[model samples]
Target: MANDTKIFHESWYRIANEKLCLRSSVKVHRQLFRGARWYVLSDPFNNQFYRLRPEAYEFVIRLGLDRTVEEVWMEMISAAPESAPGQEEVINLLVQLYQSNLLHYEMPPDSAKLFDRYKNKKQRIMKSNLLNIMFFRIPLFDPDSFLKNILPLIRLIMNPLGAILWLTVVGSAIKIVIDRFAEVSVQTQGIINPSNLFLLYIAMLLVKTFHEFGHAFAVRRFGGEVHIIGVMFLLFSPVPYMDATAAWAFRNKWQRILVGAAGMITEIFVAALAVFVWANTSGGLLHSLAYNMMFVASLSTVVFNINPLLRYDGYYMLSDWLDIPNLHTKATQQLTHLVEKYAFGYKRSTSQAYSLKEAFWLAIFGVLSGIYKLIVFASIIFFIADRFLLAGIIMALICCITWIIVPLVKLIKYLSSSPKLERIRLRAITVVSILLLFVVGFFYYFPFPNSFRASGVLKASEYFVVNSKVSGYVKKIEIEPGSQVSAGQPLIILENKEIDLQINEAMASLQESYAMRQLALAERPEDLATVEARIQAIQTRLDRLQHDREELVVKAEISGVWVVGNVADYLGMWIRRGAPIGQIINESAYYFASVIPEVHTSRIFDNEVKRASVKLVGQADTEVPVFRYVKIPMEQTILPSAALGWKAGGDVPIDPNDAQGVHSTEPFYEVRAYLDNNNGMKMFHGRTGKIRFELTSEPLLRQWWRSFRQLVQKRYHY
Candidate 1:
């Protein structure tokens, strides 16, 4: 039920439920009149709200109006012996109510109008605050505004996408292909490197940015401003993001639909043009453009941008055409109606939306959708001293939870009071409690804390994985199976007889010197001096021998993934230093890896650590567990290498605009996010799942927005 008061805490709600008795000295706003303790009241029956100030209460009691219109209407139709309900009386009552509504509407600047005006002003203030929240006072995402925000030098960049936006996507791809295949002429060394594909990919991203511009352009043709344009991530994958919330404000539904369709149309046209140019052209420039064009145009914009089920241009497209105020709302309403019809056997109507299907969907998802929106709002509102505001939110949430639970609680109380109806009440309470729990759990916890749970592979450090250096015949390997070793631990011993003999000779010399010194104790000058010299020489020999002994030890230089191998153990086996042998990998190594095409790479944001979850296979099946990255990779690889591992990089997607020129020709960027469930795999590598990365979305002005929308729709509601 909708309430249009300033605010009410959980305590007021408890008072409404009689969980906490109303206080006589409550600091309620008072006027010259009688009073009743009604801090807030929810009219769920009609999904309407009434603000009862002291004066309103006084007016009601003074008029002795014992019945509201809804109550009067009910009374006339009630099957009571005392009540007379003839056709004439029913018609008269209906006429009277209509007359009353007409009178209420006619009164100039009446209470409702004044209330609405006050609400409108409140909305204006709220809107201003929200605009500031998103980091601007007036959030106008016009073309001029965009150009102004971009660097002066960047203005040199052609918005070729604007002319034929998707064509750029196609053109870039074909250009890259032809450049690669049409035989590299004796020219710049830089042109030959495959790593150059990364640049083409970046160009594709620039094109997609204009793809959003196409959407904005269409929307602006009507009146509303485009407030936002940027990359969007759903799950963790990137998508060219844009905010078209402004389009809905237009009077015509067709305008909204046109705005939704604009981007896809633009992308398609661009992709087609790129294909055409590639097919017809034969010059070096043309060949390069044509080769890359088709892939970029089709891959980025076609496959990625048109998936309505995935929440991109497609989602808005469907939402606009269906005439749903919001697709998300409609989805929830539709589910809610399903639950009501099948689950509840067609019981309740939904508070939001037009039809049962819409309401049902919404109701089914009401708890989840509400929480999701709240979290998205939290992301945007984080700077609004959100923690302090969250307390208020928590209180408000508790009040809603209590409202949902009240019916079941009352039913339980009734069942306890009367044993005969216990079974019926029990069934009713069970269903109600289950439904209520859905809402309660949403408030308590579900998506908020767990939203960012994700994981990826950890790579070995460069020092950790080392091949055998200075190898000899495998005399003895020091480490045993399953043994853990520290850095510099002895792991192997090479046969070196010369070093062994030196050690023995040094020991013998030391012993001989000691005996001679004992024997020459009395010889003061010449004999004693000679003995001292001999002792010093022996000590030096021993030191050199020990230093040589270190070479034979073959110690482990680093700690990590140790690759154990069975080798040929023979006395005369040939060996070379820094040659092929068993490998060692650093257990604590890390790297970032991914296989993203050029189009999607454009959407990769820097410095924003997206959530990831890594999974490993195991013997026993278990619930999916998510993991977090220890650290973001310091450097991205220029060309795929073994040091980077798998050409795939550490499960971290290397946005390869530089590597994959194919995507540069696309009109829109496509990002794929892989989140792993690492809970079950103890003895295996990471397992992953697909996440539909969504860039965060929001209404420009969130606070009390639906409240204003409701006010407008109320005028039109029959």
Candidate 2:
């Protein structure tokens, strides 16, 4: 019982003399919650249902057109005062039943009051839906008759045999997805691409159509009516929806859970079929459509329908499985109760939780769900804003008004005027004011540690790029990779059969010229000169050929680690002259080449940076200090290493046209910082890492504003 409730209501006198009874059209059903039986009064005409406790149900059943409210109340109190509801409870129950059209009254004035309450209830529902513009819905027609028509087919599929088939298909699809996981993952990158938007939306509509029918058919199969079928504009995108609340009247909790999970089950089955279609097809409209269908089903089921944090199918299933009806509403009430009872020191505040375990769960779920909702909403706003700025702005304004501004106004009104807080009103106001001030101070006034990270690769300050000096096939690798070698050490050996043959031929020609010259000297002095010239020319060609043969042996020019890669794999491979073989890195000196984005360069360049450090991807825990640094003032689109670009698994965006992945889509400033590698770790050349620059402390509010401004300037060019 609430603290606000009394033994009797002052206005009970006006209803005490009135005679009322249960409407003949109202049907009662029984269900169990927390092992206790609860009765549900279903008004078929309005498709509305209300739950009643055993005591309240007894009082309601005893009332009739011939019996007055006072008579039933007096008998109930006299018979069982401990279990019986008080007069105040009775009055409230009567008013609720009357508003639900479950109560029949003989008086015209009472009927008029009930009609006004019903109209007000409708208005409140409309206002509430309007406030939730992101998930707005429009009812089209009744689905009960249509579901009834398909009852036989629904029964055929929603059974044991159907479950087996669903499992087999879904299992096969799961296997296919796992086998081709890489391809599927790559395809997901283009799911939201402008070219696929039309097909994606079409796929979503088709999948959602079946999904809503799944719920309707499940309800109808279990002897329940689905009255409303409509379109819900989820994130301003139209999707099919259905009313399955009639499942709440089922006596079996598992039945209710089944009704809730039916949609997801149907969607997964459809997605499984889509997987087969997508996997088998090559490339066409059908293939794209199948892929899109799979994308829509999996994304929606995982992100929304199956997530218990949102008020979707999974949430209802969780509630039914836990035997906790109105879990979300009760959680909010539990939080409010805690605030009133503990925070404001209210003695009369009642808890919504029935046990300590329930209270703990309620509190945890309340906090998490609230936080998740905010994150989801903010993410959606930003996601839409990236594409449609105007639509995003409108959604953001609606969310701010509904979630923040209106709630704050209501909280202030409650703290000032709530009757339950009459004695502790001043304390409540003070506590709330302090909380608000603290929150504001934390965001706008308090200093926080400020730092930014840029992606780049480590580079050796001194390194020699070993290149092949001769065009020949590799015969042998003289030194292994990472071996210490002398300056004149042979790194690799190459062979040129053509050069060897030429040298042999040149030597033979020179010997022949020498013999001819000897003969010419005895015959004619002029001929002897010509023979001598020929011998010299032949000798010169032989020397050049021998020199070319000597050049076939590739030797290290500098002493350092021999950084040849896959040394054994180079055997018999043809190498062109001047091609880079590997880098001979001098590990004594190393530096980080950090790619600072254009937006962050201005902040770090003009601000006083406290310190800078390097965190290599290979050694994430070790932070190497920067001994010295230099910033290149010019804007450059080319990255120092391809590993720093998105194409190579880095955060930096790469230009789609750059196949080498060394060119960034935007220009960035490269900061070279000599790292102190004295920390007993070797830094390799071209190793990827992040450079962290600790800057001056700033408030979170200011940081957020600056980020927002940068985003606008970058996206809109203003």
Against the hidden reference, what TM-scores do the models get? 0.34, 0.89
**What's the CA error at residue 378 for candidate 1, in Å?**
2.6
Displacement of residue 609 (Cα, Å) in model 2 is 1.9
lDDT of 2 by residue, 1-718 (tens): 2324457766677788889998898999998889988899998778777888898899999998888889999989998888788776787788778777788887657535534546578788788889998998999999788778878888999899999999999999999999999999988889888899999989999999999999988889999988899999988899889988899788899999999999999999999999999999988999999999999899889888988888999999999998878889888988988998899998656676768898888888888889988988988998888788899889999999999899988998899788778889999999999999999999999989888998889988878999987789999888889898878888889998988888889988888888888788777777977787888888888888888788899888888888977876789999998998887877778889999998898778998888999999979999999888898898999999999888899989998788999989998998999887776887789999988999999999998898888987897676
- In angstroms, the error of model 2 at 623 is 2.8
Model 2 segments more than 4 A misplaced: 1-21, 65-71, 86-101, 105-119, 502-548, 656-659
TM-score leader: 2
Q: Write the per-residue lDDT of candidate 1 for residues 198-223, one digit (tens) a residue.
A: 44454465456557776766755664
> Could you give me the TM-score of model 1 versus the true structure?
0.34
What's the CA error at residue 236 for candidate 2, in Å?
3.2
Model 1 stretches with alpha carbons more than 4 Å out: 1-213, 219-258, 261-315, 321-368, 381-493, 496-527, 536-540, 543-617, 620-718
RMSD of each: 21.4, 3.8
